[model samples]
Target chain A: MPPAALSVHLSIGQAYAWSVFKPPLESALGLSGTQSALPFQLGIVMLGLSAAFGGTLVERNGPRWAMTVALICFSSGFLLSSLGAATEQYWLIVLGYGFVGGIGLGIGYISPVSTLIKWFPDRPGMATGIAIMGFGGGALIASPWSAQMLESFGSDSSGIALAFLVHGLSYAVFMLLGVLLVRVPRSEKPVESAPSAFEGPQVSARNAVRTPQFWCLWVVLCMNVTAGIGILEKAAPMITDFFKGTSTPVSVSAAAGFVALLSAANMAGRIGWSSTSDLIGRKNIYRLYLGVGAVMYGLIALFGDSSKPLFILCALVILSFYGGGFATVPAYLKDLFGTYQVGAIHGRLLTAWSTAGVLGPLIVNWIADRQEEAGKSGSALYGLSFVIMIGLLVVGFVANELVRPVDVRHHIPAPREAADVGARQQPESA
Target chain B: MSEHDSSQSPPDRRPLIALAWVWVGAPLAYGLYELVQKATQLFTG
Candidate 1:
């Protein structure tokens, strides 16, 4: 199950590394920075929308079908974008990578989540962490691999097209391994001894959404993601800006290394913090992620520019919380709503991520851009944004505190009871 | 073979599991290598 999840996640997670293509696309297509961001932004929007809309379909069709569909849409998105690049048609790239490919990202993201939860009922957090860690690590492989490919192929339009083509074909074949291997557990076997309090009544996807716990969690995920993306979207530039006037100024190369370190932290936190959640309980784990996260942002806002190591340590911890927030959420949902229709519920919840996708980058970039215009330099450029992020994390912390078990009225009837009700309704057949 | 004989001689699943691990492990190894290479540049530069 982990491998199956990893295969799809590692491919779709390439979205994080989309910045690698920005410069090349800008130069080749004569586009502005905002224009280059259009496809990536649209892709994230599509990821949320498609996941929300396709959640029920995925639940009905099963993982194999969902995975196969994801493979087709994802690979074809790359292929179509390659054609767009080769022909120098910018709209096609948007349509292909952003719209069509985004559908793949949405469906693929939730494909293995429910299966792993069911398979490892004893350790739901750890199961999800294993899969989501791939999503965080995908950028690590892709950033350098794509850069090397662009270097080898030349940074021309033709080269970009070729790179896209290879990405499409390779990922298609790679994801097929998952498609062939994945399996739904035969039955929900009882755990020998359930340690957690989350073992409770099952809630339908429709009913799950109606609960207050769901909405509170939505706010939690949105604010947590927004804070993280603010840093991530500006990681490279922010580092350079922070130390611009120092004796040992940050080079572009070092900034790139900082991005790499953040990716490592992101990947590590997905697995490490989430596994810890299994032992510590989901709600307590999130307290650390949201509460400590705010403190990290505060530290950066106050003392970041004065010392390099302090800045890096704070940034790494903040990024870890970011990744932990994502990986931990599925298990948290399972705890609140039960494993029944978890994939669909997760899909619906991911709308928060799409909202954050736009909000996070916009807030940070807008503030930074305005600061630059006002003649602000160094850490002052990002000071306001960090303060705002601290506020967002505080809101997320309160939301996490508000979460509790679902009400009994919302739970679906037990299987035997449901069967009895079905028999009563269909007396002629009986 | 009879059903009993076939039941007694189950197909080996070790290789399939190993292949699945390989599918996951190979890419992870490559990614780690790339990260290490990038990290070295920070110090060496």
Candidate 2:
């Protein structure tokens, strides 16, 4: 399940490395920076939308169907984008890569999540974490490859089209493995909350939204994502500005290195800390993420310029928590909402990610722009943003604390109705 | 008999599973190598 999930995730994760295309696209298409950014931005927005909308269908159809759809949509997106590049039709690139490809990202992203939890009820976090880690790590593999492609083939129309063609074909073949390997594990009885302390509500996706628990988790996710992205979106410049006043100013190479380290931390935390959640319990783990994360932000705000090592360490740890938060939430949903409609519920929760995608960079960039206009430099430029991040973390902590078991009214009234989920007659060889 | 048998002789799937892991692991290893190569510039720079 993990390997199958990974095939899709690693393929789509290239969305994060879209910056590799920005310079080439600008030169080739005579595009502005923001124009080049449109496809990636739209991809994220589409990812959230498709996941939320398509989740129920994924649940109803089963993973094999879901994976096949992902392969078709995602690969076609690249092909269409290739044609767009060849023709110099910028709108085609946007529609193909951003709109169509984003749908692929959304569907591919959630395809394996609920199945993994169902497969390893005892270690839900670890199972999903391994796969989600692939998404985070995907950019690492893609960055150099995309750069190489652009170098070998000029970033011009024909060259870019050829690169997109190779990517599309390769991803199609790779994603096919997922379609072949994924199994809708024979649904046993609803996971016995059992002797385990983690047992809680069995709310359906529809009713889950009505309860305050859903919104609380929503707020928790939104705030956590906002804080992490605040740093990530501006990592290179933030690091450079933080230390410009110091004796050792951050070189561009060092700043690039810092971004790579954050990527590593993000990937590692996805697998490492999420597995830890299986042991410590989801709620307690979140307390550590939100609470400690806030302190890390506060420290950076107060004394970040005092030392480079401290600033770097704080940022790395916070980023790990950021990554951890992403990997842990599905299991957390399982604990609160049960495995009943976890995939559908997980899909809904991604709207928070879309929200943060917009808000995180806007808040950081806006404040930084204003501060620059006010003659601020170095660490001073971002002090208020860190404070705001800290405030967001504190809010997330409160939301995490407020998370409690769902009331009995939300559970499926009968045992048979509960058992009927994902228990289709189709045999699964997981 | 081949190490990976479809017959129900406990159908030793270790090799198949190992191959699966390797398929995913190889690319991840490449990504990690690049990541480390780039990350070293932090202290060196």
Candidate 2 per-residue lDDT, tens place, B1-45, comes to 111112222357667667777877888899899999999999897
Candidate 2 per-residue lDDT over residues A300-386, each given as its tens digit: 999899989989999999889889999999999998888777888999999999999888999999999999999999899899999
Off by over 4 Å in 1: A188-199, A415-430, B1-11
Task: Go through the candidates in order and give each one's C-alpha lDDT.
Answer: 0.84, 0.85
- Stretches of candidate 2 off by over 4 Å are A189-200, A425-430, B1-10
After the best TM-score superposition of candidate 1, give how far the Cα of residue A320 lies from its true spot, in angstroms: 0.4
Q: How do the predictions measure up, each by TM-score?
A: 0.91, 0.95
Instruction: Give the TM-score (0 to 1) of chain B in model 1.
Output: 0.68
- lDDT of candidate 1 over A1-430, digit per residue (tens): 6788899998888988898999999999999999998888888898898888897777666777788888999899999999999999999999999999999999999988877776677788899999899887777778788999999998889999999999999999989977877665433233224432224667778998999999999999999899889888899899889989987678888887887788888888899999999899999999999999999999999989998888889888988888999999999998888766778899999999988988899999999999999998899999999999999999999999999889989887783344223222211210
Candidate 2 similarity to native, TM-score: 0.95
Chain A TM-scores of all predicted models: 0.92, 0.96
Q: Which ten residues in a row have the lowest lDDT in candidate 1 chain A?
A: A421-430
